[model samples]
Target: MFKIISALTLFISVSVHAQTPDSLLKPSPIKTLTTQQYNALIKGEDQYGMGLVAELNGLPSPDRALKYKKELDLSPTQVATFTKLAVELKRKKIEMGNFIVTNETKLETMFRTKKLNESDLIFYTNRYGLYQGELRNAILQASLKTWQLLSPQQVNKLLTFKKS
Candidate 1:
């Protein structure tokens, strides 16, 4: 009887533990933005995770352009051009980021309040996508402008600089 009771207690404990909900499986109250996503949005950083696609494809990001300006032997005009592009990119990215985050909050509210409908859903999704594209375009266009500012030799050097 003692052994049976001990085994039953152990089984019950194990069953209870197994039935406990995992924190990972539990839904967040916000339901949309993870903590990191929220931080990036609030800080006006790239939340789309595609900010470096241009750099990965042999184009220089604005910071990178500025970083290697002297090494790339950039002309004063090129430096000025990259600076202007960087300023514009930062401005546009912040604007678009705010737009994206606002739309995302609306999306979260719709789903959270059980007010989501097909039309509203489609509208927010499309709006979010449009803003995402604009943000990416802003970054990529800056990269392209930076690339154009560099000479062919400078571009080649920038492209291969990482390997060495």
Candidate 2:
């Protein structure tokens, strides 16, 4: 009886002290982003789902327009134009994203070192807004180009595709 009680006590204590394996712990999505993901965002990977703006304007992005080129009966010229626009837009987004990321790092360091002033803060924050606006504008411009390229019938067909 004594030995059984001791074994039971040891088992209970061991179980209580057991550690959960690290593999069993779930990572937080917001906090556990990998470096590649951070780099992609800094390099303008559209982390904020900004492509939705094109859809809101009743047009597809250059990439999307290209994707549905067959269904839209796009001419070879239209295809060439969209390809150029997509490349240009990608470059613009990266440029703006690089500016914004550099500014953000500077602002963060300044704040950490207690070098921030009201005007400086406003300037930095406004710059962020401008960078975002420019990114959004580039996306919209591509959408506008796609809209111009497609006919009304093609637009209707694209809309139907969007629905399904």
Q: Roughly what TM-score does model 1 have, to 2 decimal places?
A: 0.74
Whole-model lDDT per candidate = 0.78, 0.78
Stretches of model 2 off by over 4 angstroms after superposition = 1-37, 162-164
- Candidate 2 per-residue C-alpha lDDT over 1-164 given as tens digits, one digit per residue, 9 for 90 to 100: 99999999999999767844532455322233444444655566877767686787688887887888998899999899999999998899889867876777778778778998999999999998999888988888789888988889988888877532
Highest-TM-score candidate: 1
Residue pairs with clashing backbones, model 1? none
Error of 1 at 88 (Å): 1.2
Indicate the residue-level lDDT of 105 in model 1.
Answer: 83
Residue range 1-164, candidate 1, lDDT tens digits: 99999999999999878863433444433457665565565566876656577777788876677778888888888888888888888788778867877898899888878998899999999999999888888888888888777778988888876632
Listed in order, each prediction's TM-score against the native is 0.74, 0.73
